[model samples]
Target: MLTSLEFRLLATAKAAPELRHRLRDHGHDVRLCATELLTNVIDHLGEGTPVTVRVIGTAAEHGRVRVEVTDPAPDSPPVLRSAAGWEESGRGLALVDALAERWGVDVGPDRKTVWCELVGDGRADGRPVSGAARPTAPARGR
Candidate 1:
């Protein structure tokens, strides 16, 4: 799904608490994760660009929560490599690497998509959330 953000802190930071309220605190982390990823997408690239966020809750191995933010960029794909000892900037991907259970980039000549996944409680049983109340078996046993 896609949402609008003015690419400013006034909108981004202010959004977290309000979102946490609706999701009953369970989604607070995911919200913040989106905030960070989206924030980077906005700050490091062109202004007023649209962002696409896809959130899927799955139960495979229990289940995993995946958050993907897609935007237009061709300069560089985010990487987990550490900044040199003296550099004062370029730590964002490093931080993302440290925080996410899994993270990577989907790149083409046109745009780059950076994705991150966090292990959630539902993932312990290996199922994917289906419509409403149904659950599907994992494609492969863990």
Candidate 2:
């Protein structure tokens, strides 16, 4: 299944439950990752910027559900950085990293997509695939 939407901060709050329903058993992790990615867009690119969010599911054997957030800012890619104990805000991507099987940024001439894949049988309680090495930064893809 594949779902896509024009993103807006207000609309997202209402969209969450619907997104969760559409994602079925993978709802929790996918919704959280989608929220973090959307928040990054709002924080860094401003709320009204053109953004599109997509959710795509693969075959059961693949055990994968991918979420992608595309924004018009090709130059402002997201960064993954360690937040200081006293800081309150630099942790979005870190949370994405923790939950995604692998996440990356795809830069294009007019836009960039920030995406993450969650791998599992959709049966485990919301955790990422076991033993996957956490990446320090999101990989760059075409």
Candidate 3:
């Protein structure tokens, strides 16, 4: 079974308590990205939303996790808002755009899903995906 985005957030939080730690160590800023994405889907996209999460790669903790938050609002897919500063609202997708590795929408007649994928660094055996995410050693003698 695959883990939900909420559960993934919790697991990442447990694995690395600090936000920077989660981002740098994991090679994917999934926590903040997921938060913004889900919030956008819930607040603006539609009500009674259903989000689907998928993890694909070599293994559980070493793969690309794509999160798709589906909503009933089909006509309004996510769009980038180019608003001036000091605006009353907006900017979720903008932040998502800046943060996510890749993000887009899957549109349908009666539904739409805004999806984002965060590729893991794949550090189960001490080697990172691109030599950028070196795994931190476990704390000893608890």
Candidate 4:
């Protein structure tokens, strides 16, 4: 299913349980990816940006659940950084890289989408979607 939400702190927190419920059996990892993507938007792109989130069931990677987050900032893309031990921030996409089977970004003139997929075998009610699987690749800070 496709659901668009405003990029807000509380809205991101609220999305977790709702996505967990929506994805049902494949909820756990998908929910985590969704949270991370939304958080990135808030922390990087600024809060209150119009964000579109989409979740779909697919046969890629031997059956997976895909989550996509679209925002208005094309220049502010997601990057994987090496967070030091003393730092308290900058690990959101690291977690996404670990949990998602694959993830990538789609850039446009006015917007960009950061998407990730997780290995899943359960059922969902959305169309099939495709994303690159970077299981062993280091996070590219674009």
Candidate 5:
């Protein structure tokens, strides 16, 4: 599934439910990660930046979901950094690193996409494809 959203902080709240619906089982992680990514865009790139979100699932990944957020700033990419305990900010990527199985940034000529993959056992509805719904269910036992 793919969604295009405005770069406002309000859009994050609006987009969260939709992301949760699409992700279903791992909605919380998807929502949180997506929000962090968007918040980063708003904070660094300013508001009203265009964003495209894509959710992908793959059987080869053993029930993993990949969420990608595309924005128009290839020059300003996200970086991971350690935040001091008293710091009130700079924990976005840190949270992403902790929650996402893996995350990365793909920079193009005029834009970049920040992506994160999350592992879950929930049933996915489609084969491994971009912009397609591939719900996954947890395996039996361990």
Candidate 6:
């Protein structure tokens, strides 16, 4: 499923339920990651920017869901960085990293899409599979 909307304060509120409905068991992770990505677009690109949110289900038996947030700024890719405890922000992507099986950015000529995949199976706990080899570098696509 795909939704296109302007990134606003209430955008997440509206998008969350839809994502939950589409993602089913993986709703929580998808909602949180989508929120973080939308928030990033609003914070960095300014509010009211047009963005597209996509949720795709892959590997149904394993409960894998992919979430993608596409924004108009191709040059302003998201960067994952360490945030001091004193800081109030900058933890969004870190939270995404912890929850997602894998995440990456895809840049096009005019826009960029930040995406993450979450696997809902293989762990009794909702967290990602233990000892899974997560990529140290962000995956980028043209």
Best candidate, lDDT = 2
lDDT of each residue in 1-142, candidate 4, tens digit only:
2222222223355565665565554456676788778888878866566687766554544575567788888888789988998998899899999887778998889988898867763334443443333232232333
The all-Cα superposition gives candidate 3 an RMSD in Å to the true structure of: 11.6
TM-score of 6: 0.69
How does candidate 3 score on lDDT?
0.50
lDDT of 5 by residue, 1-142 (tens): 4222222223344555555565554456766787788778767887667777655555354566566678888999788899899999899989988988888887789998888777862234433333434443232210
How does candidate 5 fare on TM-score?
0.69
Backbone collision count in every prediction? 17, 0, 0, 0, 13, 0
lDDT of 2 by residue, 1-142 (tens): 3222333333244454554554455567777888788778778977566677766554244677667888888999899999999998999999989988888998899989899887753423553322222222244532
Model 4, which residues run further than 4 Å from truth?
1-25, 59-62, 122-142
Q: After superposition, how far is residue 18 of candidate 5 from its true place, in Å?
A: 6.9
Q: lDDT ranking from best to worst?
A: 2, 6, 4, 5, 1, 3
Candidate 5 Cα errors over 4 Å, as ranges: 1-26, 59-61, 121-142
State, as a TM-score between 0 and 1, how close model 2 is to the true structure: 0.71
Question: Which 10 consecutive residues of model 1 have the lowest summed lDDT?
Answer: 1-10
- For each candidate, the alpha-carbon lDDT, in order, equals 0.53, 0.67, 0.50, 0.65, 0.64, 0.66
Summarize candidate 6's per-residue lDDT along 1-142 as a digit string, tens digits: 2122222233344555554454444456777887788778877887667788765544333466566788889999998988999999899889889888888998899989898877753223454422222222244532
